[model samples]
Target: MFSTRKMWLIFLLYLFPYANTAQDIIFGQNKFTEYQIGNMSLIITVPHGGSKQPSTIPSRDCGCWDMSSSKCFFTHNCPPGTIKDSINCKVSTVKDLYTLETALNLGKEIQKITGGYHPHIIINHLSRSKLDVNREKDEATFGVPEAEQAWDEFMQFINTAKSYSPKGLLIDVHGHAHPENWIELGYLISKQNLDSGAFTAADSSILFLSKESYNIPFETLLRGDRSLGNNIQEQNKKYLCVPSPTHPGPSGGNYFKGGYIVKTHGSKDNGQVDAVQIELPRWIRDSSERPIFCAALAKAISNFYNFHFK
Candidate 1:
């Protein structure tokens, strides 16, 4: 019997003879999503930087739709200009500004670093008000047929990319406007758990990495000398990442542990693929800083992958 990894490879070889072929595939209305095929064993997904907003599909609201009342009520406010006929509840409509550009450039930097090995990039171009591909289906599309179609196309593309690499990393790129200017490298460990030291390998998005008997402690892999945070910091001191040696934990500040992307795509027990949610601050993602930071990030990613997966 073939090993699971081998079996997966065989399956992919059968299903996609051109899985390694590099090309751009666009989906959804007005081509709101795209998948850039590449040769590297890496995939980058940008779910929140979508810009298209087709009025044919209503914006997703708080998701607490009231059938009888014909209204949706939730703690958050709906997108701007939403009327009563619309689900007028709060949903995060703010785009992750510049994340798409950052992802695309990061792919190029990775290609340069790897001598033309491109990282597969999946980009969602729909506005967050229309669809939040990171969230579950119901919350993402609010039953809008058009939005739902886009979500399916976006997610299927990620799965397809994963199929090409039995072992790889999925970097879910995002941006944050938090008070702190440091980067947030989320492995699905919450701030509370990180602060209290109450989390374990089971709680990690990169559980596959934790399961490896690398003779290295899990804590070290998380925030010690061997962590991605440390690697990125080593590449550039200006870009500090949380859960690194310098910032071991949130310390009771604003932070995002991770979101649906990492939690869903990250490997489980003994799984080959691992994922990390990278939330960058405006400083790092801004046009002036992006190219330099992408270089640093590509180096860090190459180093981390070599150290762990190679």
Candidate 2:
């Protein structure tokens, strides 16, 4: 019997046929500016959903890794379905895409629920394969120069939104590859030794999904005897947080488990702009488990918004 999640995923796969291919798959340096700005209270960014490759870069040009068949054993030889699988595996074919769609849809839902007050979304047109918004330009493999320009645009968007409303919020949307298969929220903190005002400086605030900044119940749940290391291993058993095996930090799991997007944009010191990063496991929305994931995501977002924005 198909699991409820898998059943829902099949239904959506048919609903969105365009998600299955790689041709003309636009990726990096692309920004989606479709939503209206002044009408909302939040900004949503998806930095890793891009899949487009640079025109200058060849199809098989694996950056840094030698493609020459002589030097590398697997040069120019990717396994069949590797690229396609990677795209489908990482990109939000349904829920990721649906999250933004639903926010837009929420414009109507809000009008119905509270008589007004909707949120605005700012998403990247590019895929994670192009430029990872979460990672610094130096860390990206393609369009390093263009990615910098995109990053500037992202920051500018945040500044502009704050200027429009001193009470607005910014959210960086993302997914994680882990074994636990649960939702994770991350906040930015000022990394030790870094200037507080600069974008490079990390913000060290804990993101609370519940209304209160620090919910005792939630904190206790997160602090369950399981160390971070144990959490990662356990998470991977049922979900996909990272592509491969990696060691987490001493605190328990990988110290750098959260991406750069969460580390950079989540700042509370800059009045009126609060940010949080959400990480969803792939199993939740895979071809076999999308329905269950979508419902869970919708509920999570609703809970998160109500806790903070309501």
Candidate 3:
């Protein structure tokens, strides 16, 4: 005698033969992307840390060409006085160093904190030079069929994870090489907005959080003692995070202000699940401090969950 929920799950599985249940991680075609479905209401995506660069999928062009040059250079290193051609794509081929490893370790740490509750993890295994999943379809894959299919698969996995965690957090992880050795938490608000304090809840990725029953002030949620940045900073005062209680904002410095993944999936557009783009510093992702940072991040995320979601 199956419970109603179990019966419904079984019926749906029967109807959709290719549907995935709560089990081991699954890979997309050609192993371009992989996903781990989790019981916990959290999702993490690593878009720029992929390493696979097969010939089947052509590299995404930078779209900067020298039309006036005799050689007609397609690269950015065009000679002096060469007339620059169209520059269409937001081209960056360099991979976010060690972000995939950081994300994997972060998931493990989170599971340990939650007493074995898994967090949905999605990783794009393809190299950013081959496919930039962070960009839009045309620019990301450059109209390559294989890359297109992989992109669809990656997006579908996120959608599937969203179904499991209907009202949770989606974290887009990446590593940055900014001069300042501090973490950057992007909420879809620009540096100018943060400096001027002119941003509204509607401009935030976690828009739904401001409207929750707790009645938390928007500014407090962004950089107060209970915010995610503050939690991470509390773990170790040395581990500075911009937009925290101490930092407040970037203070007219460089900041990511979130990206396409957060913009497309965050609560601002639809659904209750808020999205956050976390740009980790190079030291946190590349040095001996990786595990330490991962632990702190896991604890901070858990604290955030307990404070807000619980």
Candidate 4:
């Protein structure tokens, strides 16, 4: 009963797949990173924590930040005599010290502490020196085929993970060498903005997550008891967090506002997934002290989920 034109259109539609919908997608087999499905609506990504640098991929000409600098890229606050990149690729590309170990360990700790609430964990095993998984195409892969493929694979995995937690949280983990012994929680707003209380949920880096007003002031969600920072603080692990119960912002110090991973895959601008970038200091991310931080992070995540998302 269909017209000839309609039938032809239907045939063409079947012949050409216009887009890949989130529903029918699969994961992990071809991904450049390791991925696992979990019982909880959560995701954690260790982007710049890999130690491998396959010579097949060239060293990124996009210079990185000093491993010892106290300043941050949010305000282009690189110190004198340091590399000032207009590309704004100033955040430390050097792997976040022991982040992979900590993240993996954190996962173990999470299972033990939370009575078995598994969360999807994604770790980019390729070194940043080879491919910056957290950056966009032009800057991320530099148009290299392998890098591009890896980038696509990583993103696909992230999107796939998001499908599992459409209304939950995403935590982008990284390392920082700031002078302070605290975790720098980035909600996309800068240290200056948080200090002045001059930002909106829409202004946050987690666009999609912030779109749905959580029935609480945006600032409160950034640091209150229901906030990720608060739970981490309450754990008494000694690694205090910025914009948390004790500290509102970095004050006179530096902080990473967020990054490509947090902004792109996160519910920035519009989605049910809220994402936060947790930049851990050496005191917490170092191999020796990682266990303490991992335990604290697991508890923080469990507490945050119970109080807010659950």
Top candidate (lDDT): 3
What is candidate 2's lDDT per residue for 1-310, written digit by digit as tens? 9854344334434533333222211111333222234345556665655455565422323422222332221123444333322322232222243334433343444434444554455555544445455655533433445655656555554554445554545656565555555545444422221112232222333332222434433322222222122233343344322212231111234212345654554443335455656565555535455544443333434444554555
**How far does residue 222 in candidate 2 sit from its true spot (Å)?**
8.7
Candidate 4 residues 1-310, lDDT tens each?
9854344334433533331223222233233456555567788888888777777766665443454663323222335555646354543357678888887898789889878777778777777866778776656765667777777767866776676544888888888888776788888888888888788778775554334545766667777665778888888847688888688878868888888887776666667788899998887776788887788788888888776677
Estimate the lDDT of model 2: 0.42
**Per-residue lDDT tens digits of candidate 1, residues 1-310?**
9855445445544643334323443344457777777666788999998788888977665645455666654322444433433334456778999999999899899888888888888888999989899887777887777888888878877887887767888999999998988899998888999989998878888878877736888899999998999999999888888999999998998788888888888885445778899999998888999999999999999899878876
* Global lDDT of model 3: 0.82
Residue runs of model 3 more than 4 Å from their true location after superposition? 1-23, 64-90
TM-scores for every candidate against the unseen true structure? 0.85, 0.51, 0.87, 0.79
lDDT of each: 0.81, 0.42, 0.82, 0.70
Clash counts for the predictions, in order: 5, 38, 0, 9
The 10-residue segment of model 4 with minimum total lDDT is: 19-28
Compose the digit string of candidate 3's lDDT tens values, residues 97-164.
Answer: 99999999999999999999878898999999888888777667766788888888788778777776
* Better structure of 1 and 4 per lDDT: 1
Q: Which stretches of candidate 1 lie over 4 Å from their true place?
A: 1-29, 65-89
Residue 295's lDDT within candidate 2 is 39
